[model samples]
Target: MSLRRRILILVAVVCVLAGVAGLSFLRAADRAEQRGRTQAGGPEIARGGLSLTPGEDGPRIVFRNMAWGPNRDELASVPAAAPEGARTASGVSCLRFHSAGGTGICLQAVKGGVQDGYRAVVLDARLREVSAHRLAGIPTRARVSPGGLRVAWTVFVGGDSYAGTNFSTRTSVLDLGTGRLDASLEDFTILKDGKEFRNADVNFWGVTFVADERTFYATMATGGRTHLVRGNLAARSVTVLRENVECPSLSPDGKRLVFKKRVEGLPAEAPWRLHALDLTSGTETPLAEERSVDDQVVWRDDRTVVYSLPGDFGADLYAVPADGSGAPARLMASALAPAFLG
Candidate 1:
C-alpha cells in the first residue's frame, strides 16, 4: 500500500478507538452518579415534558358534578358534595365529586413513573370535562380552599425513587381559575432518572386543607421514614407534625384529620389503617383498627372520613366514621381519588 494510504488507515483506527473509550467513560460516570443518588437526600430533579406554564387568573374550585357510565341508564349516577350513601356504579370509567361549596374538585391524571407530569381535569355530571389544564411535575397532596379560591396542595420533588422503575415526582400548587402553577415546596428528593427503586423511597401524596384555608397538611417519606407535615401557607412555613403516617384527610370543620398509618405486620403493598388527628392539640387516635387502611381520605362531615383504598392496580373508595363506631368502612365506589363538596 502507498505510505499516505497506510497513514490514513492508521489515523482512522485511532479515532475509532478513542470514540469507544470516551463512550465507555461516559457509561461508567452514569453508573457512578446513579450509585451516588442512593444516599442523596434533597429536592428531586424534574423530568418528563410536563409544563407549568404561566397563564390567566386563578379560578375557584367548587364541588364537581359528574355522572358515571355512558350517557343514560341507572348505572349512571351523579355525585353531590356530601355523601348521602353515594355509590359508584359499574361500567364507569370515571366519576366526578364536588367540593363543599359545590365547585368541582380537580383530579390530576399522570403516568405511573412520572407523578409530576399531570393533567388537572374537572369532571362534570356525565364524566365529561368541565375544564382542564396541565401542571408542573409535583408529587402533590392537595385540597380545595375554603373560599374555593384555590386547591391547596403540598409541593415537593421526591429525592429518590425505585431507580428506573420510578420517574421523578415533584410538588407544587395551581391557581384554580388560570391554571397557573407555582412550585415552592421545600427540599425533597426523588429518584435519579434511569434507575429503578426496588421499593418506593418516598413521594408526596395526601393533601387536606382547612375550611378556613388557614392550614394545609400532607405526607412525605424518605430513607424508609414517613412524616406528616402541616403547612401554614400564609406564613410560607411548615412544621413536622408526626411520623409513620400518610393520606391525611381533614374534617369539614377543619378540626380533625384522617389518614393511613403503616402497620407493623402487614404486607408492604397494603399495610396501613385509618387514623384521626386533632389539629388543635396534635393528638392522634386510631379511627379504624382495620387489617390495613387505604391511600386517600376526605370528610363526609365532621363525623365521617372518606378515602381511596387500593384493591389492586385499581382502587376502591371507602368511608369511615371519625367517631370510630361503624361497620368496617363501606365501599363508596370504584374510584381512586375521593373528595366531598359539602
Candidate 2:
C-alpha cells in the first residue's frame, strides 16, 4: 500500500479504539451511579441526627455503613438490640472507625485535585469533627480511649495488604485533652524479650486503648513475626507481651485479649483465626468462627466479640463468644468497624 494510505489506516484504528474506551468509561460511571440508589431488600438507611452519646434509646452500635445507597460509607448507627433494623447515617464518612466514651476516631479519605489522601479525624459526642490530622497513606484501624481523652489510628505507608509478608504501617496516638500528638509509635522505646529492641523494619498497627487511658495494646511487626505489645503513653515505651498475635482487642475486664492468630496450613490471603488469649494463664482459645477474619475486633460485651467479614456490598459484622464455645452469628449486614456505645 502507499505510505499515505497506510497512515490513514493507522489513524482510523486509533480512533476506533479510543471510541470503545470512552463508551466503556461511560457505562462504568452509570453503574456506579446506580449503586447510590437504594436496592430492594437491602437494609433501610436514612440521614438523621446521630449522636455518639448514650441516651434514652439505650445502647447503640455505631459502624461504617457499607450498604449500597446514598448513605453508603457514612458513619451509621442502630440500636444494639435491633442491629438488623433501619440505620441512622451521620453525614461524616470514614474508611475505618472506633469509638468509646462519647469520642470517635475516624480514618477517612480526602479527595484532592490530583491525588487522594487520608486523614484521622476526632469526633465529639455529637458526631462533629473535633480535630483532624493528615495521614501519610491509606487508613486501616482506628480507636478511641475509654475516657474519650485519647485517640489512635494506623495507616499503610508502604505495602498494601497486611496479609502479605511485606508491608509498612504507621500508628499514631493523639491526646485530645492536651492537643499532643505522637505522629508515629515507632518513636517510642520498644522492649522485647526483656531487652530494649530496635529495628529499622519495625511497624505498628491496630491500637486498642485500655480504660486507664495510659495503657494500650497493639500489633507490632518486626523481623518475620507479629507480637502483641502493651504500650504506655506516659512512659513512652512498649513491652512485648507475646508472639503470633495481631490486632489485639482487650476485654472489658482487662483480663483477656481477642486477637487474630495466623493458623498454619491456611492460605496467606486468609490465614487468621479469631482467638481469645487469657492474660493470666497465657492460654489461647480459638473462637468458633471457621472463616478467616482480617479485622481488629471490638468487644461487644465482656463475653462477646464483634468483627467484620467480606460481604456482597462491602463487609458484614459477626459476633462470637470469646471463650471459644458458641458458634458465630451474623450481627448486621453491610457494616464494618463496630463500636458499642452505651
Candidate 3:
C-alpha cells in the first residue's frame, strides 16, 4: 500500500464526515426554532380578536356592540390589572353573546404556551366582566342571533389528539336562559367514492349561525388546503362551500363571509388574508389586503368587520370596514378575540 494514497483516502473520509456533521447541526438548529413555535401565542392571536377577552385561557367573544368602546374604569375593576386592557389601545379577538341571564363570555389568552387555554369573563350588557373563568380547550368560535334564541359553536373530538393533545372543535348550541347545550356539537361525514368517511377529528372550529338557527357554516381542511362546510342545524349535515381557505368569518346578516384563503404560489406570509365571500353569488372579494392578515373576524354590523392584530407586549386588536371601503383602524392594543354585546 502507498502511504500517500492512504493519507488521501483518510482526508476524503474526514471531509465527508465534517460535511455530514455540519448539515446535521443546521437541521437541529432549525427544528429547535420551529419547535419553539408551539402556537402558544403567535400571529393567530393577533389575527383573531387578539385583545377581546381578558385572559388567554381559550376562546373569547367580542363585545363589539356594547354601544361604543370599553369603559376603562369598569374593565379595570373586573379584571384588575390585566396586562392588556379589554379593548384598550388594542382590540379584542373574539365576539359572542351571553346566553340568556349568563353574562357575555368572551375568549382571551392569559399568557404564552397557552394553545387551548384561554380566559372566559362574564360581561354585562355594558361590556363589563362580572366574573372570569379559565377555559381549557379552544372554545368553539360562536355567535348568537339577534333574537337571542340560539347559540352555536363547533366541536371536534379526535382533532385534539394531535401534538400530543386532544384538541377538538365542536359546534354546540345553547338556549338563552338555560345556558345549556341545546344540541351538542355533532360530526360531519365526507361522501367520498360513495362511502362515508366518518372521522372524529373533522378539524372544524369556526362556526356561524344564521338568525333562523337552522343553517350555519364552518371551515374544514382536506388534502392540505381548507374548505368551507355549511351545515344545517336541523339536518346535522355539512356540505363543502369553498376550497383553499383556512377560517370563514360570517357576517351579521349571514349574507356575506370574510375568511382566510390559502394563497398558493405566494409567500408564506400570504397563506392567510382578509377575504369576503357572498353566499348568494358565491363570489369572493379581497377586502383588507395584508400579507399578514389572519382570520377570527367578527361583524360589528353589516358593514364593520373587526379582527385582531399582534403587537408588542402581546397581540393587539384592529378593525376594518366589511364593505371594503375604509382603512383599517386600530381599536385597541394588547388584546384577543373581541365579542360583541348589544
Candidate 4:
C-alpha cells in the first residue's frame, strides 16, 4: 500500500474510536444528570446536552439542602401551611407546621444522641424561638393541628435499646390557643368496650388531630395488643376504636385513618404493615408498602402517604399511594419524620 494511503486509514480509525468514546461519555453524563434531577429535585437544562441545575424555588432548601426537607407547595392541597422559620432550630428530630397559622412546633434533641434530653421548641413565623419546654425523653414525633392551636408529640423513654422490647413512649398534647398542656395521656380515662378500664401498663403515642381540634386519634397499647383510640381533649377521655392499630395518622379530609398493623410471626422484631381504615365503615385497606415500617406515617395529601425508614447514611423518607395501587417511591434521602408545610 502507498504510505500516504496507509497514514490516512490509520488516522480515520483513530477518529472513529475517539467519536465512539465521546458518545459513551456523553451518554454516561446524561444518565447521571437524569438521576440527580429526580433524586435531588435539582433543575435540569436541556440545551444541546442535558445539565443538572438547582431548583429555582421549592420548599426553600434547608440544612445544607438535605434530602428530607419538604418540597415547595408540598402540602398546598392539604389544610395546613408550612410553618415559617421552621428550620432555624438545629438538630431537629421531628417538626410540623399548622395548616393556617404561623405557629411551628418541633422536637430537638439536646445533642444528636438519644441519651440527651429533648427540647420541645416553638417558633414564630420569623423563625425566632418563642418558647421551649425541656422534655425528659428521646424525641420521636411532633405534630401541629390544622389551625396551629394544638400541638402533640411523642418521645421514647426507658428503652434498653432503641428497638428493644422494654422501650416505652410518653405522648403529650398542648392546647396552644388556651395555654393548657395535657402533660401525659396516661392520666386520661380509658374506656374499653364501653366500660371504664384502668391499667398501669397503658401507653399511648402517635396522636393525629381531626378538624375539630378537640378530637384526636392515637395508638394505645395494653395486654400485649395495640389499639387505636379516639380521645377528646375537653373530656380527657379515650375509647378504643380498633385493635392492632399503631401510630394512627388521620387523612386530610378527616374521613380515614392510616396506621401500622403489627404482623404476626415475623421475628423478635415486630413487623408492621401500613393500613388505611375508614372511620365510618371500619374497613381497613392495606397500603402497597410491604416493608416493615416502624415510624409513624404522614399524609402528603388525600391520595398519598409518606413515612421514613432507617438507611445506611441516615433515615430516608418514602411515599406510597394511599389506595395500595403503586410501589413506594423515595421522596427524600436522610429524612425521617416528615411534616407538610403548605
Give per-residue CA lDDT, model 3, range 1-342, as digits (tens). 799999999999999999999999989856644432212242111111223233445333343222122321112111222323322222333433332222354555466683545655544544555555555455546554445455555433345321122455545555545554434444545543345555544566566666676776777654444667776655666777667655576776778988766665666544566778888998888776464565467776688777765565345567787766767877655444455433
For model 4, how does the per-residue alpha-carbon lDDT over 1-342 read when each residue is reduced to its tens digit? Answer: 999999999999999999999999989867755443323433221112100111133332221113322222111111123222222223223433322245666676576565666678776554457678877687776777776678888787766322334778888898887778898999999999989999877878888898898999998988767889999999999999889888888888999988888777765575788998988898999999988888778787799888877764455668899887899987655444555544
- Weakest 10 consecutive residues, lDDT, candidate 1? 46-55
Highest lDDT: give the candidate number: 2
Ranking by lDDT: 2, 4, 3, 1
In order of appearance, the predictions have TM-scores of 0.57, 0.88, 0.57, 0.72
In model 2, the runs with Cα more than 4 Å from the true position are: 1-37
Better of 2 and 3 by TM-score: 2
Query: In terms of TM-score, how similar is model 4 to the real structure?
Result: 0.72
List where candidate 3 sits over 4 angstroms from the true fold. Answer: 1-103, 107-136, 139-142, 153-171, 175-197, 267-270
